[model samples]
Target: MDRTRFFVRVAAVYALIGAFMGSHMAGGGGLELSAIHAHILVVGWLSMFAFAVYYKLFNIPKNSKLSVIHVWSSFIGVFGLTVGMWLYYTRPIEGMQTFNTIFFIVGGTILLIAFVVFAIMAFVHGKFISEE
Candidate 1:
């Protein structure tokens, strides 16, 4: 899947979205989006970019199942978390507060699992670092 490329591309998209959100908040004279904006940039862009570099720097096998889990989980986790945050805060729909809350909490939990998987990946693949 060329995880390095995938992560970098997704990270770029997140960076753009975060920037746009930041600008919107600034120009609109409101900081309501501050938490979400920071998280989008940090988790989506920064963390994803770091993972891309991990793939680039390590000698991990391309066909490893761990990489597959890590990548997909990271992608899903980030998207879910960000969108869930948006929905939770905006509540753009009517009488959907329960759904929004559940979505937000689940998204965050998934993201945490992703992080744990990331740590495990490091341990399992750390041996490959020297091979790089």
Candidate 2:
């Protein structure tokens, strides 16, 4: 029901996953997945968590259409981008790399759109409230 809460929870989950991956590497796991792990931590965990905090701190209405759009677009976009990157680098489908590259591009574009939308929302609504 609460989009901010949902995004925060997703961010927490991503943090756990990223930490686990990092620990696994430190414990001598293969280092080949480092890029994917970094993206997971950065884009998935940090970005989403930041968005959640921004929405909550800014007092954005939960029921606002932009709220919902922000939640779903960020979720889907990050998921696609991260997974596409994982598959692209780790799986290495010979003929499919082109398709994978396109998928990654599309996901990145979507995420960029989400950021632009959020920027618009912030500039449109963000104002210093002076306590009279």
Candidate 3:
């Protein structure tokens, strides 16, 4: 699938998951899980997905290595962040505290890099405008 479609699909899935989790939280579900769900849905799903879709729809060069890097970094970052948070909350390991912190920080940094790369790609590639 194209990047735009891929991003949209990811965003939609995240939104749906968020909604389900919200309902569960409202019904007095676990607070830690709820917080993790919110983080994944908001940062992982909504924000990252929106940025990816915007970059693609704006016609950023598909051939750019930066694009590939952005996609892979984002996927890995989100996966790591989610898994780290799950482990941290469930197991509550003292040593893993530092490890989880590193995961979150690295993941966030990678995501930020993705956004920067996307913005640069978009600017360099230019937007698609219709002739008047």
Cα TM-score per model: 0.95, 0.86, 0.73
- lDDT on C-alpha atoms for all candidate structures: 0.91, 0.82, 0.70
Ranking of all predicted structures according to lDDT, beginning with the best and ending with the worst: 1, 2, 3
RMSD of each: 1.2, 2.3, 3.0
Candidate order by TM-score, highest to lowest? Answer: 1, 2, 3
For model 3, what is the error of residue 44's alpha carbon versus the real structure, in angstroms, after optimal superposition?
A: 2.6
Q: Which is better, 1 or 2, measured by TM-score?
A: 1
Could you give candidate 3's per-residue lDDT for residues 33-107 as a string of tens digits? Answer: 886788779876887677665665565567868778777776676667666766777667767777777776777
Candidate 1 residue lDDT tens string, 13-127:
9999999999999999999989999999999999999999999988788888888888888998898899999899998998999999888888888888889988998889888
Candidate with maximal TM-score: 1
Candidate 3 segments exceeding 4 Å error: 89-95, 127-132
Compute the lDDT of residue 113 as modeled in candidate 1. 85
**Leading candidate by lDDT:** 1
Stretches of model 1 off by over 4 angstroms after superposition: none
